[model samples]
Target: MKKEEVPQDESCFSDTEMKEVIYAVDKDGKYDKALSSGWETKTIVLDKSLEHIEERKAQAIANIKNGIQSPIAYFMEEHRMDIPTLASYVGIWQWRVKRHLKAKPFQRLSAKTLQRYAEVFEISVSELKHPKF
Candidate 1:
């Protein structure tokens, strides 16, 4: 059955709107101390099951989508993220990080780096590509 017709009441995210929990640091003192000293992230949950959700889910499971382009890459196919950010989290150089995000590392990967990312994220290589890898 199609997602919209699946009879599911709703999902915990939005289909039309995109949101990010930006942990920004304003060292320039742009605002009140309370606002500037901490993180600020935007989170949204949608309940509507759309036709594209299934495809996105599949890509996520297959780990072939893309990079850590955005935080919402956690839930949607179109939301696939870029490589630099994922590299930052993975502690690898951006280019090197791009090499191992396929849920399966190719010939250029090291067992140690792959294992570290897997342990830190608590997901198999396959699932790593599903998120903002």
Candidate 2:
């Protein structure tokens, strides 16, 4: 978007947080590097992306509470992961990871398997089994 169209609001990135990029050549032919030149729209896009993530997080929490899924599903959403992604991280098959997303299979997981998931999620095995959220 044009610099004139960028919204100046609380959600916009502050001066300190804005990233700089080269957008044009200066009169002397050096690159013109400034955050204000080309990256304003990126901030707006990032804010919207974060909103989507929050929405997914809320849905995951609701799924956990309703017992339609397990805490693994919730933490997967929290970590921005899918079954395949989590499977790769935990060194398991995608189908096994999908099984772990169910309460019954999750409860049946051995401590060693739970430890792999916990290590991938950067949490303790107990937290993986019984997330506070």
Candidate 3:
């Protein structure tokens, strides 16, 4: 985008936070330097991303409450992980991780398997099985 379109607002960032942006410094467009400042456009994009995450969290909570899925799904979102990523972390296959996201399958999981998930989430098995929120 053009320099004119770049946002100069700092409302989304704190006084201590800053973003580095490279800009052309010469008419020949060969020189560049990093300017430390907040970009409103970046802030807007970050806000939208956070909003999307919140929406997903709400849906995960709803699914858990309705007994359509397990708390593992919620923890997955909380950790910003997809099935494959979580499976890799837990040293399991993606399909098995997906199965663990289901309420029935998760309920039948062995303690050893639950420990794997709990360790990845940095929580206890009890907390993993019954999340507070």
Candidate 4:
């Protein structure tokens, strides 16, 4: 692709100062770097990915409401984190974290453990325990 032909379509980064670096051919056919806001195909794929994430988040919230999962599950999806990542951040074992995703085990958690989760989610312990869905 030619430098001038580099895509500059508006995308998720359109409201930000970020740009995608793309390599293209300049006027003399020399390879050059071009900064693009984004491209259509990439934006479409990103939109789809975000939609999927949102769907998962909603499912988590639903599970919490139905008592099948704990608030930790909802917050995990909200923060776009997986069990292992949440466990590492909270300095807990992955298996323990997985168990806490269930309501019974989550209710049995100590204040210190809840505080750790609150800190990772950047919320108060109260908020972590009583998530607003």
Per-model TM values vs. the true structure: 0.35, 0.76, 0.85, 0.92
Instruction: State in Å the error of residue 78, model 2.
Output: 1.5
Order candidates by lDDT, high to low.
4, 3, 2, 1
Which residue ranges in model 1 land beyond 4 Å of their true spot?
1-57, 60-82, 102-108, 123-133
Better structure of 2 and 4 per lDDT = 4
**Each candidate's lDDT (Cα)?**
0.43, 0.76, 0.84, 0.92
What digit string (tens of lDDT, one per residue) describes model 4 on residues 1-133?
9999999998989899999899999999999889999999998998998888899999998888889999999899888889999999999999999999998899999999999999999999999989886
Clashes of each: 17, 0, 0, 0
Q: Write the residue-wise lDDT of candidate 2 on 1-133 in tens digits.
A: 3333334444344545764443555556555543442344675798788788889888878888888778988899889887888898989999988988887788788999999989999999989878997
Error of 3 at 25 (Å): 1.8
Segments in model 4 whose C-alpha atoms lie over 4 Å from true places: none
Per-residue CA lDDT of candidate 1, range 13-52, in tens?
A: 3353433232333455343222121111211222133445
- lDDT (Cα, tens digit) per residue for candidate 3, span 99-122: 999899999999999999999999
Judging by TM-score against the true structure, name the best candidate: 4
Task: Using lDDT as the measure, name the better of candidate 1 and candidate 4.
Answer: 4
